[model samples]
Target: MPQDFVKIAQRGELMPGKMKRVDLDGRRILLANVDGSYYATDDTCTHEESSLSKGFLKGDTVKCPLHGSRFNLRTGQVLDDPAEENLRTYPVRLDGDDILICLT
Candidate 1:
């Protein structure tokens, strides 16, 4: 498949254990920095419309602030309750110092 990767942020823009919410092609994507690795997933919570970037990051899991739904950043799997369906995950990569995310 042809990948449409878009550079969303610089490496220095996001610190470890931090996350940022970006709007790409009118889609809400949550970019997370777990330790030194980068991960991307849907920004909206499955149960509620809360932004996952506003939530807390614990290891590779992110806890939803609204209703406490935890999701794995790497696999976008729901690790805790409140969310039945899994969030969509995107491929993330680095080019030099630019953080790129695959939208296709």
Candidate 2:
């Protein structure tokens, strides 16, 4: 069963072009605000197990600091080489002034 979407943070907490790491029921999630929408994905880079939240954010993409792997924040797809798997993405929604992440 899919877990209900939980409020991770306030909308104002994560600014555009910034990434924040949050623990969702023991799962590490990368919460990013691109433009004005919020997105949630696995915090760890698939290829190197590095923290994607600690990486640099360029527009809607995040560059992995370990191997320079770039991932699309919206879809969690690897846009560059060296990453063999797509990042795990979670459903996100805005609830009032809070950002809700679905952990299914």
Candidate 3:
């Protein structure tokens, strides 16, 4: 199947160690720029549906602001409890300053 890549954010729009939330087709996705590298994951925390974009980014891990569930930004792995399910990840691509995400 062909992948549907969508331009989500600009390269430098989100600085290192920061995160932003992008909505595509009603799906909220969290975009994290960790030391110039980018990662994408579902914005909602699995534990209680809180927005992960409102959380804190530590290195490559994002801790849920509500319940403190830490998730690895690189692979969307649940690094801490309160969120037993891993976050869904999206493929990220860079084209010049355009940050694209594969939604499919």
Candidate 4:
């Protein structure tokens, strides 16, 4: 079986191109609003364990605050090195005014 939706925040709360950190169960999730869509990824930076939600966001890429490692917000892929590990992506859905993250 797979884990289902985890409520992160209200849709009206996060502005586009910004991110917020949410704790779901025991996992730390970085919830980002890119353009008009929402995305969820592991909050920890793949390299130095820095909080990605505090990192810089440019277009669809997020740069690690500690070492400049970049990651694709949509796919959670490692776009730049020093951060060799890919981020774990969570499925996101907009439920009315709430943001639902599928942990499955």
Displacement of residue 74 (Cα, Å) in model 1 is: 0.3
Question: Per-residue lDDT of 17-66 in model 3, one digit per residue for the tens?
Answer: 89999998899999999999999999999899799999999899999999
Q: Could you tally the backbone clashes for each prediction?
A: 0, 0, 0, 0
lDDT of 2: 0.89
Pairs that clash in candidate 4: none
Per-candidate local distance difference test: 0.94, 0.89, 0.94, 0.90
Kindly list the per-residue Cα lDDT of model 1 for residues 24-75, writing each as its tens digit.
8999999999899999999999999999999999999999999999999999
lDDT winner between candidates 1 and 4:
1
What TM-scores do the predictions have? Answer: 0.96, 0.94, 0.96, 0.94
Clashes of 2: 0
lDDT of 4 by residue, 8-59 (tens): 8998889998888998888999999989899899999989879998899998
Cα lDDT, model 4, residue 61? 90
